[model samples]
Target: MVDWSGGNDRGAVPKADAIWAGVARGETVEDPVYLRNRKIAEDWIGAFLEDELAAGRRVLAGFDFPFGYPTGFCAALTGQGDPLALWDWFAEQIDDAPDANNRFDLAGQINRDLVGGKGPFWANGLKRDVPGLPRRKDGYVNPFPERRLAEGQAKGAFTCWQMAGAGAVGSQVFMGLPVLSRLRRRFDAAVWPFEPLSAPIAIVEIWPSLTVGPAPSGTIKDAWQVAEIARQVAALSAETLTQILDVNAPEEGWIFGLGFERLLRGTPAPLRNDCFALPTGVHWTPVDEAMELLRSRLSPVTGQETVDTADALGRISAATSFARRANPPLPNTAVDGYGFAGGRPAGAQVLPLVQGRAAAGDAPGAVPAGQAIRVLTGAALPAGVDTVILQEDVTVRAGAIHFQGPIKAGANTRKAGEDVVAGAEILQAGRRMAAADLALLTATGVSQVRVRKRLKVGVLSTGDELVDAGQKAAPGQIFDANRPMLLAMIRQFGHVPIDLGRVGDDADALRARLDSAANKVDAIVTSGGASAGDEDHVSAVLDAAGAMALWRIAIKPGRPLALGMWQGVPVFGLPGNPVAAMVCTLIFARPALGLLAGADWEEPQGFDVPAAFDKRKKAGRREYLRARIRAGRAEVFASEGSGRISGLSWAEGLVELPEAAMQVSAGDVVRFIPFGSFGT
Candidate 1:
């Protein structure tokens, strides 16, 4: 056994040396020396014990020397017995002892004396109080005082009692119990009453087991390689330990039987549980089961009703070719120029004898030959004027205007109805208002235009376990998160959200709310109360009110979802889980609302990226895993729990696992749906 107190000089002590020399030579020493050696060995042994136990080793068997006495009495037997038979006779004297502590104290004292005292044998180079020692001012005294100690007393004192017996009893008892039980079960009475135990027989059975194969018999780069090997060994050992400790272990026959039972339950049958095997047959769904209950209830059985698109915008125009009513109805100049009669001579100078200045919307009389009218941009053209020469091309001399350049026919002229004919179609029906559209409509003399009415969506939430945010939750209640998340989703899709508040688990209340909302809004959207659970009444209400349809999609975190209509009003019932509700609303409800509102429906955008780590998944279900995209790679977040909303906040995107995949390997191609794309 290795001495753990080497730094403290316990191994260098004469008594400890003698015991170690004896053990090295395969000889047993006296009780005092042997006990002292074992005590020193214990410190090294304890550190290894935890590792050994976790590695599936029965450490207690090696530590407990005398079989059943908590702390082995082998050293005590060695005094009057052959060293080889020390452990053999230990059990006989063990019954005479009062308690385990007594044996522990005996062992502790042996170690204390070997390593203690300020004698010449103290190899630790420290002083300790002995039977007769000069007392220092600090209460401790050195029996064999050093030259340095006399010069100046050391600040701290050392004591042997503090090291011995500190944790010996606990260590001995803890290590002994499991080993003794295993030995008793294996060798029975032969290993018990360990008195008269033969040294050769004990060595043959135990020495090889405790040796640890000479430190793995090889060199390692550093502690890390050794640690990794130890970790693997520990993992394997833990599995074995679990098997040994397990009570009521499962039987192979019973396992097969349970599996067979599940197989029968999963198989569709009249062939199920039949003694003779029958050919597989397709099971026909009942007519009622074949039909979608929710969809059928909400289906519009009647033909198309006279639904009118009426709101603030004006009525639709009947004529396909409608003309623009002239804005400022008159002939107006498009540029500042002189309005004069035709047949003016080339480069001819004219007097500025202004006939009259014509401003926009002003009426002026006709201009005769040799006379020019001053016209500002957008000013009405004077009567009988065929053209206007720009000011830059004419010069004013005295009271007359002189032509600086030759004026051409129809110069600076804006032809009537150039922008739009008086009777041209400005805007068609169903056009939504934009700034440019408004300007065009006003130009066409349209005060109001026809546009599609915005769809009003009624929203509600149902669950008895829900409470409003910032309110104290009662037993079994959780603060409502789905409602707020759903509301945000609705508003993001550009539809008006009319919150109908929340309803409890009661079916009647849900029915009343649904009926009222259906009458007022174009569509109804709700969260929760859509599962097959006892409290799920939304489906039942939909059935009672009208036709409806529900679909159990092959998607993770959102399998249970319903999409239907009530009295021609589309209805969507989302699951209660906050994450599930949010994801489903974004994928299905948002697009549906966009379609109903006459807006273009676009799929949520996602990017292809490499998965940062392995992802385990069930086959046949599409999974949307929350992940963080960093450095252009997708990394999965810690919380994958479908019910945890914080996961959504922590995630930068969602990694979509396809339906057919059972697992995603690291660096595999994955679709990373950025949260920003979904209006996060």
Candidate 2:
């Protein structure tokens, strides 16, 4: 446990005897002094408990001095023996305090014994033992050293008394001092002396033998391994030590009580001390090694061919420009109207006899004078007609039309080639097809188009402990998930997914599969068999068949990935874990596939969002945590464990944490990448 004292003056540390004596005699100090002392005592006790919690201890019982005394003493004097009953009474007293400061001090004091040293007084883990005491003993006693509390009296009363009996309680208050008396019982059980409580100290048990094995005497291979071990130790210590300090430490020593139990449980012993140090000079050649091995294998060659446009709707394709013109050239009326000769009819009142009706697509003919032709919308106009009068403007009377106003020439009439002229450029080259493009092409009477072919991606899964989805799992086998996921992802990228199925852990089997896939597909993807496990055969197979490239990216959940080429086709080997495999595929494989497919892809869209809670992380590593957006703020899923598949399932997006920051506070702005950005 990592516990420490909080106040500047030693007197802030509670003396069980003084508290018990005051309670027993019914002698209360002035409200100001009482409030100040209680605060100091509570602060010390809370710190001690927090340290224990950090060390990973479960507290069974806890005790506080004067804060718990009044109720416990009153109960004892009244013939009550139940500890819980005494605690309840003490809680009521603290809650009933007049002001917030007093209430907090009392709450801190009472909580020291109730909630395992956690309450209002000392942050999240510390428990206050008194709500009415000063925050610091020295601060209360000496407002200013230059101006004494009294002309002759020593101004350092609080500090002097605190240091003198820092860990001991006076004999006068022995009976009523619940915290000290309880601590005495605990020490007796541990075989530590209960006397000499004035040592201004706390006693913590070091259980290195139980929590962690003896310190390692040999060297380790990597820094990560050492750091991992340290992390485990720290987690264990926090749980164990928290409880011990909260329940068993003496009031006076409460501020100083903190310790951890380190037990080593595996074959290799754990490193000792509070931290682990790993060697820093180790060098790696992952990329070079992968490439060297791949270069030795021969690649298969194949001829490329083109596919028709209709079949390439959902596939990647090369684009080309096309020029075309509309058929059936002729001038026609754009709207329903009557065709007349010249600009307008002279002498508007004069009546013209009705002639033949000219509808759309009708053969063109000459227009006679004193004759009006009834024309419908889109109809071809007669050779001599230059103007059209809309049907709405003319009224029929006695089988003849009577016009109220003159009609303008060429009004409501469509000219030849108005929309698209002959041999016009309809579309440019290298453009992807859209709904509008299809309509325009059909309208131009074009029947065919040129486009590029879609790239085919082959997906393979390799592992001895893997089984197909339909099969039942054996004792140690798990179902393969990477292949299906990769296939779906490939499809989403507008590429063909060529499933190679599952291969055994054998290197020859994997190599044969890769060899066959390389000949048929433009790219290959494999999951698992990338790590340096005893049975890992991906690297070995790649080396035997083609050139490979590996990257040690500075990102979490996808660190162990291999990018290489098999017979000129790119091969991406993702980590076995579902989360890591998915992340690596998006970061590396997706972009490569886009390049091959002739799509101009850009980085995923991200927005700034406020974090909903505090988050702790290590520096120097970029972390992407699955999160959800609520009210424009990013909230992380409750379970963030890498192995918890449910965590991903519950997340609607991802939060990108940069490498420079080690911790994230509530309301801090973070970059949020919605799941839609990944095509999910």
Candidate 3:
């Protein structure tokens, strides 16, 4: 349990009543920790969570602040039923500075709109009077007539709407919600009532007053309350704890150990069975299983195309190619010299010149025994000739050619089928014709080649806040980074990329755009709107169409993949984060697209190398960390946040951790995949 605060730093010495933290693990309950400032507290909490998670321990942290405001307050402020939407809404509206904040002023503005006068929240402690703020409560009105159920149930609990008085929790609500949102983002955790309970790390609300009595002697009440709450919550059985969580309302989150007030009173609690308070583990699709499933469901379309050898570069071969005829069907002279029938001793190199010269493409008639023929390079030699002496080393004296160098049989002569035999298999089917390969094919007497037709793939980006790069960006707007990026990736993968442009969050616009693309392209790839959110409409649009599949895979920087068919054309939906979109496109979509285009499945190759740093990972998920091989050691980025585009830029490759792989120490061997393997 953590005692949260809204004020600035408590310098030098930690305040006796400021921020405090407590922990209970196994049968041991630790003392409450003191945090003098917000920055220190945040740092300490982040570090502690990382340590516990890295050690393969489950952490369920409790914060002593309201997770939700009064009833009807959220619906009146933001049109959303789920309390998480409100957390995100507050996260967006509030601007937090470490030293200070505008909580009082923001509360005043909310009061002006909700109450139409000084009200609901009216007390101010600031030196300057903000607009719509009442310095003192004289005729203040309350917009919300009732306190929240959780607050009402907990006796002596302060109202969330009150601003600046003793026991007032208004500032904590203004400040804590945003901090909680950021904390949830920083770790692989879940916020109570806002996110799923499957995560090992849980951030839940706690009201000590609801379960704690006065402090023991020689200890502060703030710290004692924290210790008691953590101890009591940890001691409850899983069956009992889960019942409380499941029965709690989603809009109004429940306090921990709410009904077990007297079970562990005034004493240390005991450990229970291994049953978890929430879901025990994560279940994700294996990489190979997913690949085979896609391959089995999709039909391979490989239309044939006949093209000249010059136009066949980078095209997949449709059929095996064989040599039409042997290279140099007859024996030929490899040099411009005198061709002799003398396979005699090494000293017998003198021969008389013949009457006719054997120029290139000329087949001189059979030479009589003991006779010699003068032949040019590439000219077919006479039947009786087996050796040739270079003209540069021979002299034409009188009527004979002479050489001083030693002569061997078959010297300077090319035999039949020396380079390629007739009807020999040269190029195999499904081979991507490279420049050298194309040249070699032509040399083997190939003129026209058959290849598979290039696939037309459409790339699309969806989000209400996204716009074209060249267009001016307004507030809360970003350029369409995913479409252009994925388009480049698709083109680089040897398929044609068709730009489907950007569509907003509206499902109708997305449906029309996808339909149009389905008519023009064989496959479509979209990024964003693949997660479970109200703004996610791509899945809904595809659902209306004939076939649509959505999946949740356990991989970092990659969300669930959405696969379906639109008018016989395959569609791939990637995550909205630019880095995640790129990773998914390469790891999963690239292979799936290759299968659809009738290309062979190629697994990426990786090397086992030592790690440069230590890492703690979840057991049940396959994770890829952006890293670079530095001095033969795989080093990952300091920050793993997907939004940092520079992480992708700095990474030369990825360090892959397999499912069931856990903590890794420096110098531990890990599999590393280079980016070149993906053809990036």
**Candidate with the greatest lDDT versus the true structure:** 3
Which lDDT value does model 3 have at 180? Answer: 78
Write model 1 residue lDDT over 598-679, tens digit each, in one string: 4444456998898787877866667788888887778987766779899987888788887675677878889998877765
Please identify which of the two predictions, 2 or 3, would achieve the higher TM-score against the true structure. Answer: 3
Q: Ten consecutive residues with minimal summed lDDT in candidate 1?
A: 249-258
Q: Taking the tens digit of each residue's C-alpha lDDT, what string does model 2 give over 1-680?
A: 11112222224433312211111001111111121232344444455446645675533222221212222233432256443334344333432211122333443443354433332122211254344233333323211122112112322212111211343111112222333334434333121112232322333322111232233233121221222222233323445444534433221122112232212121112212111111244223232232333332222111112233344354332333333555325678877877777566555543464567788778887777756678888778887666787788787777567776656677777777676664565654334456666666555554444343566889999998899999989999988877888899888877789999989899878878888887888778899887666776886665545444345556776666665656566677888888778776765567556655554442578999899968988865577887998887889877655566777778887888876657799899999988777765
Cα deviation at 487, candidate 3, in Å, is: 1.0
Clashes of 1: 23
Query: Would you list the C-alpha lDDT of every candidate in the order shown?
Result: 0.49, 0.51, 0.77
How far residue 402's Cα lies from its native spot in candidate 3, in Å, is 4.5
Candidate 2 versus the native: TM-score? Answer: 0.45
TM-score of 3: 0.53
In the range 163-274, model 3's lDDT, one tens digit per residue, is 7778878788787887777788889678776667888899988887777666755677788778767766775678857765764557767666555554434221221111
